[model samples]
Target: MRLVIAQCTVDYVGRLTAHLPSARRLLLVKADGSVSIHADDRAYKPLNWMSPPCWTTENTEGPTPVWVVENKAGEQLRITLEDVEHDSVHELGVDPGLVKDGVEAHLQVLLAEHVELLGVGYTLVRREYMTAIGPVDLLCRDEQGRSVAVEVKRRGEIDGVEQLTRYLDLLNRDSLIAPVSGIFAAQQIKPQARTLATDRGIRCVTLDYDQMRGLDSDEYRLF
Candidate 1:
């Protein structure tokens, strides 16, 4: 992975156009082929980024060097560098991946056991279904045999949805399952997350943690 802190200007030209004026910012170039620019204030969000399966080239011969990042989808991120404060590369090896919290772990198990709750005739393909990025919580098939990737979270928030979105992007790239859908499941879902999921065509299901595990009180039972 390469990290660069530079005084630069940025322009994103694609479905939408955005620009960032000359300023000192942190730039990241990951071994996975992803590139992102970050501001000092934001926690995790990048000012702009180009997801993997893209190409990046740097032109440093002139007074003002520039970096051009392009993807197959025709989107481009242009970074014009005025001054470089810091630049370094690191070899961070194999990642162990995220460990599920207690509630999240339980939710994954219960969802895997009752896959049909996601959709009629849905059958569990596997839990921790591996992808290039990370393991999907649950992989399933709908009534029509369409692929569905589910991400289980204790609390569904924007970051969770973003994680699921990345998984969906990678999962849909498989030729055998070139059109995989996604389901974001959690005990409680935030409004912003739900809105983003809906806009992305990913379904959202609120899990009833106790009821699904047969732990709900008797008075709450319908029968």
Candidate 2:
């Protein structure tokens, strides 16, 4: 990875056009062959970028250093560096990606082990129960053997209820689980989400991360 901090102006000519006026900004030339320009404030989002497969040509004969990056589609990003403060390259060999702890994933495992957390006599049918649309967090059978499709979230919102509704609508179509019901389980459920779940006849259960994980507390502690 190559990092360059400079006083630069950028222009993007592609599906739509954009301009970033002269400012001190970061330019990233990644090993993946992608190039991106970033301002100081926008966190991870780049001010402008040209994704690979792309190529760049640099010109120094002009008054300022100019770099034009072009992709196969002929989309172009033009960067002019008036003054370079720093330029260096480093090898960030590989990333292990995100490893979440005490997230929805952990909650799912806790709930699955203690299926009773959901209901009395509830038995887990499977985790990540697949449907045509997508996989459900947990599929269980209540004491009466009625199938229950559960959607798990660290924070349950109206959107999570809506997601479960879609799964229920699809799961109920299958004769084998035609009478499937839904449970919206979360560590913290907003009142609006609870109301939406109730209106849709979906049960909402608040998970106790402490009790589940032996966490007297976790990252997102809810009362």
Candidate 3:
């Protein structure tokens, strides 16, 4: 990873245009070719970022650093460094990846046991249903016996909706699961993401983790 603190300005042109005026900011270049600019605040969110699957050209031959980054879609981000404050590179070892909590992984288990939460007559075919891409959070059959693919997240974002859409596309290709539908389940879903999921014909479900747990306990108590 390369981190550079410099006085720079950034311009991005693609589906939309954005500009970051000159200021002292942190420029992060990852091993995967992704780059992000960060202000002193906003915690984890970057002022601007270009994900991997992009290419970057750097010209240090000049008085200051200049980088031109382009993604596969031909979207470009041009960064012009006027003055360098600090520059350093760190060799961070392999990442262990995100560690999900009960709010994420365990919720899948609770939802599987109570498939009715999805809708009446919904029966769990399995949890962690395998697909060409990855394991779906839950797979079930609806009231009409149609296959349903549920993607559960702690917090639903646009990407989570996109992911479920991909799984649905792949599952629908299988004759056994053909005509498969999708549900985006999360404790909290962004309004924009919900709108996108709905437009894509995928249902968005807002989950109540504690309430679901309470309902599950009630079922066990009755049994």
Candidate 4:
């Protein structure tokens, strides 16, 4: 990864146009050819970015430096630098991927056994519930005895919500499983994902791993 803090001006042209006036900003160039510009805030959100399948070029022959990024979609981002504050390249090496204390499968098992975590009268009807698309993580029934199809994840994102929506769509088509609803369960759920789920009439449940594991109690049941 290459990081550059520079006093620069930026402009983007494609399906739309955007501009950033001359200001000190951070520029990130990833090994995958993705580029992003960031202000001093907004956490991980970038001011603007171009994902992979893109290329960047830099020219320092002139008094001022110039950088251009172009993606396959014909989008172009041009940066003209007046001065460089700090610049560094980091060799983060190949990542080992993500390591989690408890995997999604484990969470599934725990939730299945402690079905009440879903609601007051909810009960696990089946695990790895089969569907035309794939197996749903958990099949349950709510207090009103409505079929509830659940899709579990370590972190609930839009994709997870989409998966549960697909399962609900297919399941509800069957008369025997008609009127099925969905619940997206995860340890952490993003705000956007929660909104999407709610708009789709799917409930979002944030699971507490430690609580579900009964780590606070010695009488934890693993059945």
Which model scores highest in lDDT? 1
lDDT string for model 4 (17-106, tens) is 999999999999977677899999988778888865688888889998888899878899989999899999999776542333467879
| Segments in model 2 whose C-alpha atoms lie over 4 Å from true places | 1-102, 215-223
* Residue range 10-115, candidate 1, lDDT tens digits: 9999999999999999999997788999999889999999987789999999889999999989899999999999999999887767898998999899878778
Q: Score candidate 1 by TM-score against the native.
A: 0.93
Candidate 4: lDDT of 196?
96
lDDT at 56, model 2: 91
| Model 3: lowest-lDDT 10 consecutive positions | 214-223
Q: What's each prediction's TM-score? A: 0.93, 0.52, 0.62, 0.53
Model 3 root mean square deviation, Cα atoms: 6.4
Best model number under TM-score: 1
Q: Mark the 10 consecutive residues where model 4 has the least summed lDDT.
A: 214-223
lDDT per model vs. reference: 0.89, 0.84, 0.84, 0.83
* Residue 148 shift from truth in candidate 4, angstroms: 23
Q: For candidate 3, what is the lDDT? A: 0.84
The local lDDT score (0 to 100) that residue 95 gets in candidate 2 is 52
Per-prediction count of colliding residue pairs?
0, 0, 0, 0
lDDT of 2 at 184: 94
Ranking by TM-score: 1, 3, 4, 2
lDDT of 1: 0.89
